[model samples]
Target: MTALPQERRVVTAIPGPKSQELQARRTAAVASGVGSVLPVFTTRAGGGIIEDVDGNRLIDFGSGIAVTSVGSSAEAVVRRASAQLQDFTHTCFMVTPYEGYVEVCELLAELTPGDHAKKSALFNSGAEAVENAVKIARAYTKRQAVVVFDHGYHGRTNLTMGMTAKNMPYKNGFGPFAPEIYRVPVAYGYRWPTGPDNAGAEASAQAIDMINKQVGAENVAAIIIEPVLGEGGFIEPAKGFLPAIAQFAKDNGIVFVADEIQSGFCRTGQWFASEDEGIVPDLITTAKGIAGGLPLAAVTGRAEIMDAPHSGGLGGTYGGNPVACAAALGAIETMKELDLNAKAKRIEEVMKARLSSMQEKFDIIGDIRGRGAMIAIELVQSGTKDPNPAATAALAKACHAEGVLVLTCGTYGNVLRFLPPLVIGEDLLTEGLDILEQAFAGV
Candidate 1:
């Protein structure tokens, strides 16, 4: 068993001489639009550490944007994926067929919420699964309108780009996006105009009313939302909000799709974030942590709804590639064996206690929120709710320089998020937080 050293040891400056050379190479070889939060290239990453080319052992808190929840190169994942690779990498599920794909879908149907008969289709990424989910919903309902909430991030595809709310990098200049897509207010408790207590009912009412009046619920196919907003700063929509909206969708024939791409697979101390709200979305899109770093996504839902798509209507060449499916099966085994849901809860306890203590000391941390390992702190000006993106940037830079990988995200770009792998040792997790505290002080 080759394992990471599970320690943070910076041998040189943040981006040492070796990494500097790689940066120059990347600048020329990679497209400028492709961005990286931390520029130092990784030589290997597993457990809680990422060893960069510069030989700096940085504590990983980002988890490859929540993809490595079972840990990077997990033993089970590597073993299973390696076995599949040896047999064959791809026959393409759409072209031929494979047991691996069928097994993964069976697992999804069994694991995902709802007792009803369910079915799933695999895809290469979260965006593709989401697009297909929308396709299935529209086909089933015979409607064209799709509703998404504010601060929701679907993907970068033409349809998903229209679904995503952010403008600067995701949507700006990329116009003529897919039409019949409508946006509504999410129950963002922190920044809600009315107040957190009333955010659920008020926001739900507003959203339902808008869908009925503006988009016409009769014409709406799906109402897609993230149970815990990911890039939108890990905002957990207020309690009662998801349920109310789900009921409305049921009243109409609209599919309530939960985009659990970032908050699924034990990341939120549950099989899926929707489970927190007792929301069994008619269709659910999953990815990110599904395969322990492998590229795989699934749209799991009611059997009838999924069957609405014709035989050739919902598949891609690389959809449900055997290697990825094998990896997903391995990841599921690891999750059950390790009881990662409980591990994620423990992480939440540790993080919330530490971050709440920090919040008392530092006024810049306006709000510390999120469930399980998926947590974040919204940076703000002292004594006010004013967003402070500058401070957010400075703090993240400090953490990076000190060999702790932290990521920043928000509609205003003023929130710092922590997504350490569930397999991280307590000592390493604590050390990462210590570095984060030091970063805060320095900033």
Candidate 2:
């Protein structure tokens, strides 16, 4: 067996020699608006290992924020994308459609949760998928209002920003946002105003009441939610919450949308997180892991709802570019052949065991929650549930210093989320967990 490297060897500290040089160049050449997770510039990535410019190989736990579920540079994904590039890159689907695009749509219709007749539209990014979902809802319902939940992140676009709940970086100065968008409380169990063990049904009832009272249900076109909130921390909505919301939407003639951008494609042990709850959404938005690492996203929904938008209103210049479609096809094949759903469940078992043990040893670990491979550990004050943002930041910094790449999330920025690629070796996963435990001890 080829031994995977463990115990981070810091050759030249975190950034090292080459990364520092590249960082300066990146500062000069690249747009400052785009943010980077780690300071080290990556040269290559495979499985769960990312090799930096300084020749430092680190375990990647963030998985490009849950994008590369099949792992970066999977053989099939690379081979298929390379072959497609040689054939042709673009000829927009609208201008002249290709078999690759149609094939991806067929796969999506078959894969996404729901047995209803489905239709799909492709887009260039997660935000684009989200934006189009909204347009489709509006066209189908002929309603002006859209309802989003608190701590929910839709996208960076102006309309999505208004639909999103976070205020700082996503919505700070960029609005005057789109009108008729509203926010209600999410079923976040932790930091829940009422109590810790509140039933999901009760939470959903309360939220539904708010919608009915504040924004009449008849006026609402859709309710968009993440089955498991991504950037707002990996908080899975309480059990029964999703089903209840779906029921309310159905009763009120509102479109129920599940934003599975971060939680889809076996990332959550199931094909889609919505499957866990048996909640069939009227629409599902997917991206991230959909096309391996290529820029692609999609909105798959009930045939009636998707068809509501006029033919000419729903595409982009490169929405279903052949290269991206090929990558997506390969990704789907990889997910099946590798049994990534089983791998995700296996990952969750290991994560729960390791992180639960860490919680017993570390007082800062307030809560450990998530399903399948999508897990998070929220840091808090020693004896209270107060968010310990400083300690969380310090722990992440320590992990990075030790050559492990992890990420922080949560509305208060006190949660460390683990989203390692499902293809990662058990030894590497354990080693990364060990690093996190040591970092917590040091903090």
**For each candidate, what TM-score against the reference?**
0.99, 0.97
Question: What does candidate 1's lDDT look like per residue over 56-132, in tens digits?
Answer: 99999999999999989899999999999999999978788989999999999999998999999999999999999
Q: What is the C-alpha RMSD of each candidate to the true structure, in Å?
A: 0.8, 1.7
Check candidate 1 and list the clashing pairs: none
Clashes of 1: 0
- The clash numbers for all candidates, in the given order, read 0, 0
TM-score top scorer: 1
